[model samples]
Target: MCVDSPLPHLDRPFDYQVPAEAAAAAQPGTRVKVRFSGQLIDGFVLERAAGSDHEGKLSFLDKVVSPEPVLTPRVARLAREVADRYAGTLSDVLRLAIPPRHARAEAAPPAEPPPPFTAAVDGLAWHRYVAGAALLRALADGRAPRAVWTALPGEDWPARLAAAAATSLAAGRGALIVVADARDLDRLDAALLRVLGGPGHHVALSAAAGPSERYKRFLAVARGSARIVIGTRAAAFAPVADLGLVAIWDDGDDLHSDQRAPYPHARQVLLARAELEHCAAIVGGFGRTAEAQQLIETGWAIEVGATREELRRSMPRVVTVGEQERARDNAQAAAARLPTLAWRAARDALNAGAPVLIQVPRRGYLPAVACADCFTPARCAVCSGPLALPAAHGVPSCRWCGRPAADHACPQCGRRRLRAAVVGARRTAEELARAFPDTPVRTSGRDGILTSVPGEATLVVSTPGAEPLADGGFGAVLLLDAWAFLTRADLRGTEEALRRWFAAAALARPGAPVVVVADGGLVAVQALLRFDPAWLAARELAERRELGFPPAVRIAALTGPPAAVAELLSLAELPPGAEVLGPVPAAEEGHERMLVRTTRSAGKALALALKTAAGARSVRKAADPVKIQVDPLDLL
Candidate 1:
């Protein structure tokens, strides 16, 4: 027998009895097994009730999978809110929020002790770091806290994480540090290992760490064996004891999403964790996301950074190169296609015995392939691979599943011999090498090419992973494909382009010529030309406001099977002023997605309606799966 709460109509929690053998170690947060409909199912223990509503009839817990109670009161409470925010379910949120159990890997030996990190954090480092302290305090207080948002220049950002780790360890507390990429984590881990060396102080938590390593680290955090934790998006729910701070670096990056079931984003999990744990949070990035700016405006966070001039001294000089002008002037076209001035500046800098850095907007050999004539996507019939003319192989290979096949004629247009429509790091590298043939052209992107190019006579082609230049400086930097960015249709396309531009520019030597390819007339271009992220953010912020998007309102998306999504949309009981945008058709699977937008005042209610609908018994009985994404970056 299973204990169903009387409020079965609502998506709320119900308690189940613990089996006699498991009761000894059974805790509120532990995972438990229960018999429901004559089948064993997994369930979490919200609490251990003294008695039940049943007249002395109670189903004992089947078993306690682990002694560790993964869910905290903070996590449970926040899970409910998250479910509501994205029109998701507590079960779904839980599934996304908590990492899976690894019995085999859980028993592995702990990693070797890290080297001592005792460098004095002073001056530039100290100032940049102190701002993150607010987050450190919230975590120590033991409340799931809201995520934080802060904007800083690239030059001043590296040491900020070190300061966070120092602050946490200094307080005799533990923490988990997560970044958007492997390189960022490596930098943070190295910096932390140098600043606070101890086996239990800090650990890099990534899927690449292997199951045993991850499990050992996970168990350590759950057991409160480590105080400081560091990893990627998946590490958001890391069970650090006395969880004090949850800091998200560059929340704007798409890499923050889990890309798996429950499909949670780091920012969401951090905020949920903060709210549940009452921990202070800090979301810091070189550029501000409207979402973060919204948090600041709502009095949830404080803004911290240097004055424009102070930042400019540390910031690189940016200039825009017009493609139209280049096309008009054959003289300019002779230099390069990505951006002539930027490319030449990089070459000249390299010739002067300094490394040059380049940033491409999108990744892969062409993530999106379209009909050359009609501009409609040319997908492979066998596997939906975007057809491309590979410089290495004539046959195009599906980027996703890697099925190689001949380019089929565009069924719609009967056009064959598709051309490379999009520019990527590989293409960029090939072009740069041809331009600076004599100079060594090192590249990094999806190829695992590290960005640590020697800062002498080298042209480094990278797609964002190239950071803090291996030597702490690059003589010149190129912000290529500026128009390639302006042409993108995504909401954050411009914002992300600017962020990448700023990040790449930050690698340049002060006063070095940084060239952007977009026309200087464009807003994003002018913003870079002016070296003003604040101004750009303000403009983006205003646009978001006028559009009734997040910062002004909360938005949630439901995508998956069309019928299921439509069903969820139909059942939505939105509060007044909380409007439903669409059961609109999505790009794939004829999938339908319903977007719920709510004003600030009605945000919680809208969230609640979604929660109710998702957890409703009627909807659950329908037995359909719809992916719920809150603050979704990919609307298509």
Candidate 2:
């Protein structure tokens, strides 16, 4: 029995005796209540054993939770693998893999089998990429063909993904497509309905769905009633039988990273699942990630992208803030945020009766503020948190503590007045509405998000990832305050910035103007101009390799009280060639972080060592627990 305990010391499965009354229901994969440590706890029957290995008598299971088997052997193995890969407990990984039980949903009658589906293998969508058609053919032939696809600008990615899924279903195999979020899932759901001709053939899974609904859909997939599953991150482990194709869209999106323990990325999970299931896989996105680039570099996956000719025809015309524009603005371009050139582009697009898209890095009215006198950052005296203005004339307040900084002064300058340090989507929208008074203006961000907009003469200001889709795509795309993204302290700043730019730029109509407000010489800006995300990704990957950073080497981040961190490192049997970075001060007060690095080849060993040490600490019931994150997204 695999006890549902997250404690690393009790991570292993324990042998249990089944009472004769419940023997019939205590089958492998079924949820059961077992007595562990003198307390009744939930557990899964991994498998039946002929005899007990323990010399002592095995404890009998208290009772079976349900006769219905929710866990599958395949998923159980996948969960175990994920746990090992992330230096996390198997129980934690299992918790992520399986959703909470909804008894009512399980008791409901089984969903009717889907109607017969005959997929039409449309080669039109794949014609742009050289190997795209081949990928579809391989899927139809039930052959696993791993690929890292760079989606073309203005591409109907949902339709393309649906086509791939259709191809796999045609071969009598299941397909799992995990997108970044609900919006993407909805689009894919619609496309699948159109391509497969109905809802029964596929199920859309998301955490946002009501518990009953989510569990119902999950049951459909687990029971093999649904052959295609499309969902957000958690659906990466959806139990699709005879899985043929596993695809992930926008693998670089931070939304794909789980916030819970083990913190497995959807892309990595899908890749690992594909390898385990001997199925085809596709990692397609508007922008590529260094990890995806590594897959291609290591020859584990082939690249599928449009040729130069096709790219030119499909991509919008991209340009950065040029020297002429800067000269015309008298070097006030930075201060203006939206320069004259950007204004002209919006005007031209409006004149053409097409909507324009404006992407802001921040989401509120004024996310950051500074002292007017010395340009020093304004902070809250009580909490030392940066101050922000929620409205045009609103008093500054501490963003962290939420305390009004009515009498705030800059510690550095002792100034009473404050100025906007970061202009966000709301404020940008206000400015645009005033500039284009005659045209309708809309904002999409944290305050209020829009899914789609009508294609007409209007202006749409949005934060990155929240841009609304226009009917025929936006006529122009303006990326404001590029420095906010590029200047972030994280290592993936440039990569993430480029991703946001590409995602926003891809929303423009072919041949439309996409302007980025940044120096033309910057690598990210140049890559955006050329619409070559793969090139930028490759370059970044090479730089990371040279610097011995992630994708080249695996680094485990251990953050906790200083003593706890030191104890973990001392106890861990680090793999050979492991390099320890620092017990540097962490973001949390009185805590520090230490980074342990090792070659990619030693990653598995390193994870095992850490896991063992963590288990040892758990056995000792260490006072302070160290938080271990393998391949943490942020490595400042």
Candidate 3:
């Protein structure tokens, strides 16, 4: 019995005697309640055996949670592998893999099998890439071909993925496609309906669904009634029988990373699943991640992308209002958030009856502010946190403590006036609305997101990842305040900024002007101008390799009280050549973080050593548990 306790010491399975009454129901993969540490705890019956492995008498299972086997053998094995890979407990990974049981959904009648789908493989979208057609044909022939695809600008990616799923279904195999968010899920669903002519052939799984509804869809896929599964992050683990294709869109999106323990990325999960199940895999996105490039460099996956000529024909004409423009114009124009050139582009697009997309780095009105006189950042006197204006006429308030800074003053120069240091989507929308009074202006951000907007003349100001689709794409794309993303103190800062820029830029109509407000000399800006993310990704990966950063090597971050962190590191039997970075202060008070780095080949050994050390700590009931994360998203 694999107990559900999260204690690292009890990570392994334990022997349990099944009562005769429950024996029939206590089959492998079924949920059961077993006595552990003198308390009844939930567990999964991994397998049934006639003889006990323990020398002492095994405790009888308290009760059978359900007769329906929810956890499949394949998923169980995958969960175990994922747990080991991340140095996390199997119970934690299982929690993420399996949803809470809804008895009504489980007891409900099985869904009718989907009608046989025989749609011809439409490789129109894939044909743009050199190997796209071959990849589709391989899927149709039931052959697993792993590839890293770079989506072209204005590409109907949802339709392409749906077509791929249909091809796999036609081959008598299942397909699992995981996107980044609910909006993407809806788009994929609509495309699937159009391609497959119905929804019965596949199921869309989302956490936003009600418990019963989500479980119902999950049960359908588990029972082989549905051959294709499309969903957000967690859906990466969807139990699809005879799995053939596993695809993930926008793998760099932060939403793809689970916030819970173990924190496995959807891309990694799908890759692992594909390797384990011997299924085809595709990681396609408008922008490529360094991790994706690593796959190509290692020869683990082939690159499927368009030629330079095809890219030039499909991508928009990119312009950067860089140092040359600043020199040509005045300093004021250079300082302006929406410069003269950006204004002209928006005006030209609006006059042509096409919507203009303005990509803002932040979401609120004034995310950051500074003193007008000395240009010093405004901070809250109470908590010393940065003060921000929530609205145009709103008083400045502490973002951290939520206290209004009614009598705020600059600590450096004692200035009372504040100026907008960082303009957000709302403020940018307001500015554009005033500038283009005749045109309708819309904002898509945290306040409210617009999935799609009419292609008519308008100003659509949006934050990254919330850009609304425009009919025939936007007339022009404006990437505003590039510094906000470019200057972030994170390892993936430039990569993330480029990803957001490419995603927004890809929404522009063919040959439309996509203006970026940044220095032309920057590599990221140059990549955007050329619309070649793979090159930038490759360069970044090479740099990471030289620096011994992630993708080239593996690093595990341990964060907790300083003493606790030190204790864990001391107890850990680090692999040979492993280096331990600083136990520096963490974001949380009284806590520090230490990073353990090792070569890519020794990543598994490093994880195993950490897992063993953590288990030892758990056995000893060590105080102050340290949070262990492998390949943490943010590395300062």
Candidate 4:
């Protein structure tokens, strides 16, 4: 049985004698109670054995916790594989795969079977792709092909994916789809319900659902009552029977990465599942990441994207407004918060009876503050933390330590007055309110995000993803404070900025104008104008390959107290050609981090080496704990 204990030394399964009362219930996949180290713990029955391998007498199972199988045999094996891939314990992966059992949920009636799949319900969006129809055909035939699809903005990708799932179901196979967040989940769920003509055949698993509902849906999949499962990151491990397809939407999103131990990314997990289960895989998104591109280059997945002519015909018209263009008009207008080009676009859009979308990089009021006289950034007097204005017409306070800086003096200018250096969504809304007093100004962000805006001549100021969709689409879009995004210290800064720009621009009606307030010479800006995310993604992958970065290689991050971390590293038997970075200081006091890089082909060897070291440390009862994260996204 796979025990509940997470101890690395005891990661393997153990043989257990089933008592007379529990033998009938202790089937493979069922939960049972077993004694380990003088304590009773819950575990899943992996398999039935004829005899024990250990020479010592095996202890009898205390009792059977549940007669129902919580995990399918395929899922149990897949969990073990995922654990090895992430250099994590089997118990940890099981914790992620299996939710806490609820007796009430188990007693619920099985979900109704879905209506027979009909080809008439095929998604219309597939017609726009170059090979979308063929891919759907392959899925229906259970061909187990893999593809990396770049979905067009404003396209009904959920419908397309749901149609694919329908095709799989028609073939008497199951499908599992994972998306980025609740919003995506809701959209996909609605689309699936429509495509399937009902909801009883599929389970919508979401963390936002209460424990009872979540467990009920999970059991539906585990019990083979649902042929399709849709959810967020955690859904990647759903125990769908006879899995024929696995799809992940918006793979670039951070939410797709699990935050718990092992920290397996959704895309990678789904890819692994496709291999293990011999199923088809689809990694579809509006923007492509370097990892996805690598899959195409490595011949592991095929590429599916729109042709250049189709892209130009479907995408919005994009224009870049640089400082030089803004300065040619008037010096005073150039120094204004809104550039001359943006001002004209907003004015024109408003005049044309269409809403204008203004995307700011940050949220809140006066997110960044500086001295009025010398323009030096304001900081707290006590702790020297960066100061910000949380509310309009309010005193500035430390963003880090919460100390007020009402009477603060700049070190450079010794000025008491503070000025706004970086404007936020709320501040932008206030300014737009004053600029066009008669027009309605709606703000969208963390405070109260609007899902959709009414079709009207208004200003919708939002922060990135929080931008509300305009009915019939907006007439114009303005991407403000572009430098804030393009100049980030992240390796994917340009790629991410272009993604945000494309997302906001896509909200505009076809042929509508999109003005980006940044230098036009940037390759990212060019990619945005051409509506070619694939080009930018290819460029990013090329650069990473040249630099020996991720997708082209594997990286492992180890973090802990310096001495403990060093000891762990010393004990690790790194793969051949593995290179060590540094024991750099971490954000936490007395803690340090280090990175190890190896070729992609050697990733498994490196993971095994690290797992061996961790297991050895656990057996020795090491005092210090070191966190090992493979293929880490956030190096900083």
Q: Pick the candidate with the highest lDDT.
A: 3
Across residues 40-83, which tens digit of lDDT does each residue of candidate 2 receive? Answer: 89999999888988999888899999888778899888888899
lDDT of 3: 0.90
274-337 in candidate 1: lDDT tens per residue?
6666665777776777777777667777666556656666667777777754542533335446
Sorting all predicted structures by TM-score, with the top scorer first, yields 3, 2, 4, 1
Q: What local distance difference test score does each model get?
A: 0.67, 0.90, 0.90, 0.86
Off by over 4 Å in 3: 323-337
Expressed as tens digits, the lDDT of each residue in 346-427 for candidate 3 is: 8899899999999998889998899999999999898989889999899999999999997998889887999998887888
Error of 1 at 630 (Å): 3.2
For candidate 4, the clash count comes to 0
Q: Which lDDT value does model 2 have at 136?
A: 84
Q: Model 3: number of clashes? A: 0
Note the clash tally of each candidate.
28, 0, 0, 0
Query: What is the C-alpha RMSD, rounded to one decimal, of candidate 2?
Result: 1.8
Q: Look at candidate 3 and tell me the lDDT of residue 537.
A: 99
Q: Candidate 1 overall Cα lDDT vs. reference?
A: 0.67
What residue runs in model 2 are displaced by over 4 Å at the alpha carbon?
322-337, 412-414
TM-score per prediction, in order, is 0.86, 0.97, 0.98, 0.96
> In candidate 1, how many Å is residue 135 off?
9.2
lDDT of 4 at 168: 89
lDDT of 2: 0.90
